[model samples]
Target: MRRFASCSLILAGGLSIVACTPDQPAAARQPVFEDVSFRQDYSKKYSATDTTLALSHVATDRNGAVQILSSRGLLQPYAGEFLYPGTLVADKSFRPLRDKKIRAISTYRQQRVYLDDKAVFSNAWAGTLYKKHTLPNAKHFAGGKDFSFLVSDGKKLQYLNDGIAWEGSAPAGLIDIVYDARRNAFMLLSPSEISVFSATEHTVTTFYTGKGLTCLALTNNAREWVVGTHAGYFTLDAASGRQRGTLQRKLPCADLTAVEEINGKLWFGSVRGAFMIRPDGKCNYYACKRWLPSDTVIDLAPGADSSVLVLTDRGLGEICFKSMTLADKAAYFGQQVRRRHIRHGFNATLENLEAGNLGTGTLDDSDNDGLWTCMYLAAEVFRHTVTGADDALENCRESMDALERLYTINPMHGFPSRSFERRGYKYDSEPWRRAEDPEWDWKSTTSSDEAIGHMFVYGVMAELMRDEDLKKRAVVLMDSLMQHVLDNNMYLVDWDGKPTTWGKWNPEYVNARPAMVGDRKINSSNIISMLQTAYYFTHREVYKEKAFELMTRQGYYENLMRPMREITTAPASADDWSKMLSEAWNHSDDEMYFLGYWGLYRYAFNDTLQANFREAIIDHWQAERPEKDALWNIMTAVTGAQQFDLDEAVWYLQEYPLDLVSWKVKNSDRGDIMKIDTNFRNQHTAEVLPPDELEICRHNANRFGLDGGNGGATEYSAGDIWLLPYWLGRYLGVIGTPDVVKP
Candidate 1:
């Protein structure tokens, strides 16, 4: 998906600037692709404290309903609107099975069969006891064609047909039983080999032999059986019972514990997690609490819908796949933002979620409230520009009001506060300052990242929003903020008339660090962009003059144009501030740089500076390729680059987990990745983990971080984390409209 650049000629106040069109026609834009179908995971987690819910096996009943078995009894799937739990089978009116400890279960034609120590029962026969056998105990059961069935109790195996019990040459150490309709036989699995009991011949024969075998399942095509072992799994010839190939173990998880073929795909449950092998030979791994109640999977089964049921020791995980487009996902996240994340018109997090329950969440404040609101407001602005949606416009207006309040709530001249809260409720104590209203307090010591983010959105709103009121307000704020810096010697002076830490853009402060330090390049880049945006909107001579002086006289141009590769750890002789800043790559600065690129390139004083800024932006994006961040890639598309990793961008979007709860996810103990020694960028593995496989985080965090979360204590907002990149991609024509397709 590549497109030629489409430019909009803007003539404002006797100045001309050409910017990328956000609402260009599809005919002039090449589509990313015909919005194809992708898998979206939905999980249901159970508590770990309850022993009665310790499931061991899962299978569908005769009515195609899921039934899980444990030592206590059976349970069924319980569903709700968003998040839900499971239900006890006895509560669903299974009176005869209320208190019985089920050992095995099977589904026959129009009947659900269960077995205990000495009796077999059927739900379709209007009686609990369908037959009585002399078996001391039964643990595994399966049904063959007609009334044929088999039962095993780890040592003894027996066959039954039409109520006649026939003794067979039983194999010791029996582990499981499955019926092969293609062969009209019963397959008995042990630790080392498989045996087939031919119902017609009334004899047992060796089917296949293997070591460390645990479980097996017949394929939907009826041509092969997938056999699982402690190491991995392999396919078997259904007719000849011959092994297909060497055991294949290269997977997201080895140590296979159970296997099931559902919907023409092989699904596996390992000691670590569960995975489904798609038709492309790639697996979609489901691990961590995000996708399961526990990582230790016990069994797998086909559920009522096209979903798969993963039974773990803790509970059941039902993963349903839905066909959706990026536009559809944006709409879903839009609703999610409004429902739970909005706090006083600012896009905020829902914290203190008890056990990942959304109903128990409370809207919380953050230190980057202004930055978060800027990104969310920009998303709505792009959405409204693309579709003219009324709700998007209203969201933009409301969030913009909150942003405007950041400036007015504090008494400091043109200094925007980081966030505000009701009196005595300020979460953090260090940086809070009382407001004149006597009922509120606003955060002080706002950093350079917030400053750049505010300027970026103000510039975007001024150029793209259709409402004149918003446009004028954005211009006024842009000028006021820039004037504050210009009047304060290129620094954001706080109430104490001193430069705040990380808010120093003065030449003396920025150039004091070595060339390799990131602050040198980031500060130079941000200041120039801020100055350029102020000039572009206000048409003031002072903004242009100040920008020129910094670029030519102060050596800021060379600093900003430095190659991204040159940024490394500061020398040992450097001061503590510079060394600490260069200890690892500051990903937060990446956020600031990309946000500043909007103003850096779009509102450049001339095309020559814009061209150099394009190179800088692309260089930063190249360094960030391993992360495959959707927002960075999409923002780099603003430079009209042909190859911005569009495929990887789509992967990032599609693989993003729908549940944004900050659940504790551990991937450092995984066996699939090739861990490496720590480096400057903290690259943990050869390839970064997929979005759903890792803990949910914001764009500013390192994507390579292996393990992090708050243990289901918080839920992050999708407004800035997801919607902004999606809408920005749509605005720049890197992503196309949703295709009309069936789910």
Candidate 2:
């Protein structure tokens, strides 16, 4: 026997108190909030300690301690601790140092300072420090295994090898020099040219020429160099000096200041931030307050394996590329859902509250609150099924109760309002007013979208949840809603005793339209799935008989099998319904089709018609690939379609930005993207806007739209867009479960 919590009574509208017993099972109690602290801990554990000195240069010593050179002193991290300031020679202007033969060479006001593991040695230009008794009057230095080169006043280049000195002249307007040990040569850079000087051959040759050159680094093979210019970076062949293609995307900032090769990846630092270009050409950008202390990146250097040390004007930051995983990401987002996204018992479609706190505003009251809440409940149900967590089960129960209230709050039997509130609850606009019941308020004109969401969650609960009481409640809700449609001629009757605008799915309504109308196909597909799910959960033969009747007489199965390409807009018609239904392609229909497909493919059909359903699903999925929608791909995977891109699904999860607030994002001025022709049915451009530049998006939004804004009135929640795909991917075995220890 399951344990139940105590019941309570509450007064409504100053009437007599009424008994309100919330049937919460013992296993489904309130969840204790856990701090989402992984990212913070990872940031703290990997970042470098703060230093007060104004740092000018940074490099990694052989011992893996990052050496810091400031205007007045030197510092180095000691044995995984904070940077310890080292003693500075008085009145000396120190040039940046380079590691050579497990030693670092630092130049102090025309004097050479050689630092090894044990001690630091200062030698004047006239002193006998090595076989060569003279050091060049240089402001910059580059070192190799057996030679050290210096650029004096950025023009005269001199190299010391085996106590012998060789001299060369840099191109006019020289800026910096670096040694490529693999090629046994020194690369000199000016504002617009690169010159490679070979000390052995006593020759200097211009390697590449381009305008706005700022920084360069050789590849791991020493066969090509990555050149960072003010515009963007590209690769140049070291031997032929020929330009390769530009990177997959331009760096975040145009004023490139530093570039380095770290663990086979090219790290570029610019005035805006730092970015890493993998060998496969995928770019990962790091910037803003979460990833860096400041946006002005000074330099980038390699640290311990796979870690890159970032130098900014404020301080140093170290990031380990492999420290984070997908599970950690899921945990963080899950907490965001619980904290900022929940309003009352429902999930807010648009969260306008401050972080970690709920706000008092009209934004919390959304028309589709029940729908979003149901989707979130489905995600938690899947999570509970996968992990067997008590908290996830509790969350699902809470959302389920909220969804049920949408039906019971309205006086009309089995008619679910879009949303409901107390009589005094404030609403700013239309669709929300006092219901027929003077003590309550409800949103009217609820459409088919709400019906789809309610049925989807009801079916999932009946299948996955273990509680017997909840299962019985789901059955009752399904029977009530399905019977309402059946009794009312297959149309959802609204509170006004008439069919809602989009709730018509009867044969007379759907089959009267042309074959090219999307509504005809979508409505037929939805009603079949609804009847099939209703029968499967309720064990009612009426639902199964109705499903068969529709398939045989109404031709719903044939309607659904029509190829997606054939569903195009027809010519304008005289009738208003026909004109509206055949006007253009509706992405809302895509949402309805995929959501209904959960039941259409999963529970509706047996082995006989499975192949036909699979064909229809694949046809729709193939047409949607250009949008690269993760939700559609993961949903289609339930039908065992091998053509779906699993890697792209993971990329979508990872590339989704952390900012969940619905900020206005505009991209009309971007230069890197392409434009395409637009028609009434197809509005997608040639290329998708990069994820970072897009607004907080939902599955229903136009994926290829170039400009979007949320009106700043509400912030969208990521619960459906992110949590649905992630959990569905887990349920289908397409995404692996990480070793995440429960709190």
Candidate 3:
């Protein structure tokens, strides 16, 4: 296991002992399986302004195509289509199934059967019709083995097989009928009882009775029967009418509207949403716009390609699963970043999307453009260092060009602008200033976040890149940025000749904040990291001099070493700024601090300082463990800690939704999460929801925020948010290459 901190071969004069190349692989890496879980949601809006709100049932035919029953008839999903309802039509019938009114539908081994008030029909089987007995106003249908079927009109239950019909005692309050092939019987579900009618005996016998049964499903193994009710659901042994377990109520939602057994997993639908019982007993809840068009789940069924189709009041949510490795996911995100997230060489957001359509969006600038670009740049640098991919190198070069332009675009010598755009197209209200070139505009008021990101990437490039020009340019940029701070009295001077609000690292401004305020610790940590990075890369004595001065003379060491538990809200007597800054945990500071850790620990002035930096990083990681953040966990691994929640980090990566649309998601009213009292960190629950269930946001946003998002108007880049940590893990040898061939 080669640590990057110890792997650096460069001496004080920047002499390399060995040339790094793509062929050089890291040793002692653990291989991760390629089969990772990810979700793909399929939905269609009813109208331009309305989602489909009348879906009733969903099913999959033998051809592995999904059919959703809604008020508008059967609907199917088409490839490359979104937000358009594709109504299903009969294959060879004179009258299409879409035109005729369908009351009930079912799929058997080789046939898709449907029934109206008049007669039952099939798309596959064509047995002799039962002309002797007329249909008894059938409203439900279930297909059995070899054309054997059952129908119920909510009053009587009948078995129709081989042109003959046998009447069975109809259970009172009949709701649904399902065929159990293993038992060769029809399971009749009523409000409070289950009656099994054997085809051989032709007799209906009471099997089980419950207080408020709504639906029933036999497990795939035919060992247990799951029954749902208005309150919750429970299981029973299939052989006997005995309870398999106690009434299980700890679910995503207790009000079970529908239930289905798919792929050996029991999926429950409620008025609020749909959830699946994982093997571990915890529920993988699927709610909000991210999973469904609406949260009112009406039905659940097995879907095509190992997926689940959730029919809600508003359209369908097809949760599809595809086998992928972390590397495969990285490649997918690489294509995603190059496809739409690039804006003038900087990784940017796709804003003002039309109904979450990926093609109907435009790249837009943000306040932290430099920071975002540098994060993406670091990802590319890590990728180039690991795989030596030409595309990754090209990406790094292009982004490096953009970052270098930021320093020169503005009048200040080393003050990097937040972002830049062509002449007057900039629409943001941020302070946009004119560049020397009349055709361009540059944003001002760069903060310490950007500085830290810049230093981190620069240090990474200086340490890892094989290209001499890039390494030298990185060192030069580091020297320039640090010299600017030193020349301007340890501050990033803005266009108005004043320190940017967040760029002040001078002792006067930093020490003024109370000890408990997070700004004090974060500022001290970031400035020292910046100085160390500058000194390490350029071997400049001034950077080292200032770093030691900040540590010994100005009490910055004590500030940085303060235990994370000691950080709290400012006292009542504190100033308004300090109070506001310490009101709650700033997740943006976490991003800044972790990003700074790369340069802080790796580019330390001495081994003893490196040890202290490692301790500080581990302390911060301990505080952040509850979030289960992949980036934070992976970044903490750089410090060589024994345990950094690697499993949680992998879970974070695997559970992150592929859909980056900023769709409105609400979970504050969820019954599953155990709500905790408010605290300084604002953690809403004992455990945070998976990334996909929450709103789409950058790593800087709080993972515990229950609800947020614009109504599907924006899409975020995967570059900084996803690729950075994955590639960092790869470079650090904590994550291995795909176990299988690249797909």
Candidate 4:
């Protein structure tokens, strides 16, 4: 529509195009280069006014006959993408899925991907469904064609399969799939389970992954592969299910996606965008903010030319490999350059990864936490404010003479470790497939399975960097892991025939415990991440059930939380920790931890249930007040939904606070460079608290030391981002904050 890239557009149309920098006033720091791009597709606009969602995530088939789209990726502002419009699952007046509740949508030829909007309104939510302006096209392709399943009991899947009848106990949520040449099978993957069925038959090996798979990358060695899961990413033993080594993690984080190998370089995407390591073991990243114009790259497909195609929030953008430009911003304070705000080198993030800190290798001196900062910094693309920051994004152009090879389209979908290596990571291991356990006593945690999970997750991210042919192969790899990890023997429930500890502790229902015991059981959080994909691919009720079960049956307040009553201090691993909190309670059944509680709370839905959770949260956090600290206390207030005296807490939080994300986009209509979304003013209730107040609430807790034994903040997790949700909730006056209109 408008040509704006590579040209000096002092001012394009009505928008100011200034140089980028925080030093200059926001007005002066306009977008000097709009990062504009256009696809010279003589194919014409397709006459498809397709009033549908754009590609949130995308993948090209090995056959090149179809483009698979997921419409969902990581945890970002928008719920998910609206990629494919063909399979909206409709009745008569057909249209792409267009309901507000339809959180995400992706496409891959015949297959489609979807994620439910746990927020806004759900199917179980009756009031908003019948609204006058609601989307008439709202429907569930998996649960039922007519969009009948409600949110309260709706079993939204992580992925779906071609068979629509909804297979039971098949591990509900399925995400990616791949063809396995070794076994001539199709590996079906999901959060709850992984099923590898013969392309010619249905022989399978189902298994479970607690935190869900982060990525899946295939090695040049066809027979083996890598899998990144909740714990970490690692290479796997093709036959033995042994982990090679972990390539990513710092304390821990999940939701890994995207992976690829270009010109001897390896690449992968995690929370934000892509990353890469050079042939010589150097690493680098892509500046998504400058290169692709999206904070996160849902999918990265290599092009015929040594370039990469990135699917992001804005649209499909490409970075030409041969046309590489080292990002360098001019130093204003240095010599008052001609440009008001200087633009730095082409892509600093990439350079950093490959060269280590400040143009060095892994030996450049960095600690675990330091290494993580570098990784996250590289991933960080330009913030929305356009202050010229490197958010996560990486790339590789020069192709292998366009030979591009990747995951197969069948089962056993994954790569062997012999592919690529990073500064602190290597392809030194194989896939991990643990057998199931009926009970506890024999259960034990192994670094191997956990490591492979991480690899699978990263593999997904790497495939995104490949060409169309390779992208399709990546899906096949995903299918293999799902077959073995998600459904077949999910829960990693096997105890090597030892006395199982599963079901050892009572699954907490609200505030009550049903039964109890100990010895740590197989967990299920990792499977949750995979569900978003399964819901889209197969639409299996079983997938939805798993997510629902985890969300409902388990929680931090009652089920998995460590009893502080008899606590000495927080334990790192389950093995190191004690079961009894204060001698008053002892865990005998399943071993529940903070991860379970946090993971479960992530996908909570329902008005009454959410309220119920609110009460439990209040009770628990208030208890932790004894050891109240900034991190822990603020976390409790945000997620727990506890009530507090507003103006009072507000003053304190503002007086001393950390970071508070604003959900509403700021407007620039106020004669200022940017504007604030005042809509949140009327969203809060008098009884509820604001972010500032929320901060104050925590500090106050720290003062008296109420629940936590007055301890300090625990390591922050992605869950910490809940601040976005909390602020958004408050701004909308949906539950908290003063609902009084500003004007």
Candidate 5:
């Protein structure tokens, strides 16, 4: 669950840094990928939160298969039992793609490495590189506060933390370091380089001479490691420094850039493509261009413990690591089945899909298409939910609770509908201001509380796919929102005797003349989606009727979906985040656009969205969009390269990087409201912070919430997590499970 940072603006009082300078254009940015060294360094950052975060160098799936992304932007599928989507990524990218296609995913657990704090040293995230803040450094830090960046000088591990150093030695040519919980030593990997150095044995006595380990990564077992080189891919003994076996790839000198052992087999990537070498000497290869993208392999990355990111010359991509294996897939299937049963009603799922039921009710659920969307996903999507795993049911429960809290909230204090229940309603910041009125500049008529709920609602549903009880509750909650809207005709808009509710920013854009809509303006967000799905499974009229009615009213999409669906990118300015987080920026071309296309897509897999409105969205995207850096641009480039077309959404992702602000405007600084004004705020969190508060904020922004919680303010927050459930859901799957929706 994420911390709901109050969007309340303080409006004054704080050390605000103008993040961007007016001298530069709003879209200005540098190329992130232009630097080869940087591209090769994607593995530098380890975040359990990054679902689509990519590492282009080496990637794999749950089945220990490899995925080789080509230069042309196509995805290559491998022949192996994949337990997850992309590859098995861990704090260590546990396994690389088994040669561009077949990959392996880990059933996460506490991989304890017995480290002899005295003899050998290793950082959990990155092998020991420097002293981290404290003298007797064991401090687990997150965010940039104590974020460790490691680069080896090829002999010993050097650490950098708070201007101090914690030095430790490893085997000669120690290419990779693994935490050995059993011996409490750092295991080094190189062809002939496996040594359990006790701070005394800096050199290796037992070296597998025949191996030339060029690339290395850790595995689920801190005691073991995945090693790749010109010789072949293989896993080695950490304690004994013995070769387990040669990974069975057919390539003469398999350029195994990545490797992971899962389901009792080996997976690795080479120059030409990806491959999976079974224990029995069988194999599977995922040819880059032959399947999708070009043949050039670049970099690979793994996220948290969930998604796998693959970086190529074009852009980055994400895939589930565990979904590629038989065990994890079976486990994921069981979890989804349980979740489906837990859902209050399966019919509700269909009802929402066909009818649409969000943005128009007292009981709010931001992700309108939850029902059908969940249906669109594959069973393997819930792989992380298997009974016993890292960040398991506890994660799902906490996430659901946060979403429920979001729905019950009322925002803007007493100036508007201060109550948490009707929290999203806005007030007349500037009365007599009307979109139709010539003098009416777009003014804030309502709070974006509802808009931001997209994160909570979508996150809840995503958690449901993995958790049973939460999934059922989520469905029922969606059903209730739809019922509320149907009973009240105008789906949850602030039509309280007002002619229209004016808005300034769409959820994803900012600065330009803001857009306004009638109080009845609604879209598919807000859990209304469960209706169609419910109807489909139950054959109930209420669900279907309300869904269609909601759709008819919210038919004209707004700015939210545009950015929500826009190619993903990091913000270039504070204004950009504010705009992106506003309801005014929710500019979807139109509801009917995706609607018609969705139907068409069900039948025709290659259908393209040519609606004039979609084109308009592209125009709007380009007009107000900012430029991106190379790393960020890689995403857009992939989109451009994949869809075979150049458009605004793709371009934004491919070229924009957040601008550095010199002038900071924090929501809490100027806020005169109760400290609760701290509600719905941005930047202000950084302003009001004492050293303690800053420490907490640092926690909120880390790879995973190690302190506060997964969704802590300084840990997990609704804002960042929102991007994962909503946008990623579409690209990944909806209720349309991969097996069931292949239709």
Candidate 6:
């Protein structure tokens, strides 16, 4: 049964609907499986064939020779007549078969058969010799079970039973026919109509009518028929001729050529490619050269082991739906993160290394490597908690070690560097200087974002890590970082012996701004959370004392409690910093605010304070839902707020394309998406571009933007965007663990 994440909070009434449910039931929620489809060309595999098969029509003969009718003439497995060879044949005048204008072919009782404008004939090698037979006035032929055959002569349909007794003509204007054993009847189809001729009733019944209906197939349940039209396909009730549902709105392409049901799945072949509709009505598309020999799918045939044989104009190919699952996809992408994106245990990189191999260079090119590494470490820690995997624990330890180096490598006590590198190695043009130790160098200009990330991970590690040494290490780092701020009057001192820009969280700087300024509330909320986290892990009274001092004396708590919707752009001030703060939304600040909330609501506040924090978090999340950010939604779920958009969070994760390469994606001229006007900062456009067409995206990219950078060149790691939210969802009990079936 399909199950979704549940919410307990009543969003409209602001009341708790129920107590939090136990984790076991939440863990048992079933995951909705979806198909990730890609296309490829296999035409090159058959380039050495003797004839250029156009694949206008394909059928397997009795001897298992896959024959294809091309513009060049009849081509099959063998060319010679008496001693038939396995080589491809193109001659129409071979042996007893001499029809150049053949329309269709079928296998009947181990006999190779063909139909032309005038007759139906067969040339079979029987009893060590070739035997031939021809029946006149046959235009087309369709074979059914038990050697039953339906023959058409341009205008009439006739059925021949297994005993070779001819059934009288029943209908005119018939274009194609197929037999359904379940109904014990023959289905006759025309360009715009379908009729069922039941043998028992000896009556013809019209089933459906639609313009340009091209193909028909019985559904897996044998209760309905999938009728394909030029625009799309729909389901029609077999017993009553009532329309079940039309799927034109759900299809990716409309110009369908053929439709077939194989193994309970409906495969629609079209001019653009093929679309497979599952029993559950989920659609998966295969059109590109990566999955198809050509975009023009002529026909489809069922193959062994639940696979489908695709006949395109270029060649034949097979699609195996069982080859991979969502678990396999997640594991493959996780491997990609480790192999291609990791830099010294950090799972996030600004650009992928060339050739799947690292060059002789330092991995500290990204200034925020420490922050990205901390986020990755938090993901691993959550993974370990959920799955109890020793490898995930080991990964967390390694990443934590790298994160520790960011603080220790710098000379200033308890101050973390933006990033560190080996001596004399430089690729980026960011500000850098040699450390006190001669062997390495570290970057400067660390911002508040790094601090918040450090504290967030520190809180999580202190709670989740089982090893005593790791726990102590986390507490020590928390103490040192918090003490640095306390000693330096709430500012992170840079290498130049001054407060770095964006590192000022002191009461003086925060209180000087108006309440309407975003930084005023953001700084107050972040500092309170940092102090709370420092106190929670270290059990230090000074941390709590400092937190309350700011809240009570500087109005920090009230500032943070202001409804997010009430905070808007403030009037410009004379000072440059104030003027900058008065501008419209800074999305980076949104990233920092949500990231800091992990500690703010989870570790800092008691039950009473947390209730108020939940209100603030919900308001912020309500404003952020328009962006459809998975990270923000997942983070909000940790607060246990009802109506947190859990479904949209999962949709974001599922809709995110598998391609993580940061190719340049431009969407300014796209005609398919809706465009709206916006006044928010950093939101360049209102178009919600498809994931595949957008630039290689990360969590921070605007989801509604029309343009992305990279020039089709660099690709970034999807670790932070994918792994973080996925594991967080698991840890928060929003995403259930999938059942593992060992091979």
Best by lDDT: 1
Per-residue lDDT tens digits of candidate 2, residues 106-217? 4333344553332234445444444332323344566654435444446666665554367666688776677777777878888889988875676899888878888888
Q: Give the TM-score of candidate 2.
A: 0.71
Which lDDT values do the candidates have, in the order given? 0.82, 0.67, 0.80, 0.30, 0.31, 0.66
Q: Per-residue lDDT tens digits of candidate 3, residues 187-292? A: 9999989989898888899999877888888885888888999888888888897997688877878888888888877889888788988888888888766667
Model 5 Cα lDDT, one tens digit per residue, 1-743: 01112222211112111111111111112111111111000111111123353333333433433333232111333221221112223332332222222111111122111111122222233444323332222211111123332223355454443443345543455555433444434445665655443323333344445457766655645556667776556666755557686663444226656554433445454554444453555443333221213223444444334444434443333332321212222233334333332222110111121111111112222222222222222112232432234543444454445435433332211112211212223343433122332322222233333222222343334343645666667556544444444443423334243322322122221213133321112233222223433443334566545543433343423432334333232234434543443433222222222222221111111112113223433333232223211112122221212221223332322111111001111212211112322222121222121111111121113211112211111111111212222222223222112322210
lDDT score, candidate 4: 0.30
Worst 10 residues of 2 by lDDT: 38-47
TM-score of each: 0.93, 0.71, 0.91, 0.27, 0.27, 0.65
Clashing pairs in 2: none
Query: Which portions of model 5 miss their true places by more than 4 Å?
Result: 1-388, 405-466, 491-539, 550-743
Model 1 weakest 10-residue run by lDDT: 19-28
TM accuracy, model 3: 0.91
Ten-residue region with minimum lDDT total, candidate 3: 13-22
Instruction: Show the lowest summed lDDT stretch of 10 residues, model 6.
Output: 39-48
For candidate 6, the clash count comes to 8
Per-residue error for 615 in candidate 6, Å, reads: 2.7
Clashing pairs counted in every model? 0, 0, 2, 216, 213, 8
**After superposition, which runs of candidate 4 have C-alpha atoms over 4 Å from their true positions?**
1-54, 60-169, 207-210, 230-232, 250-255, 260-265, 323-743
Cα lDDT of model 4 by residue, 1-45, tens digit: 011123222332222222111111121211112211211110000
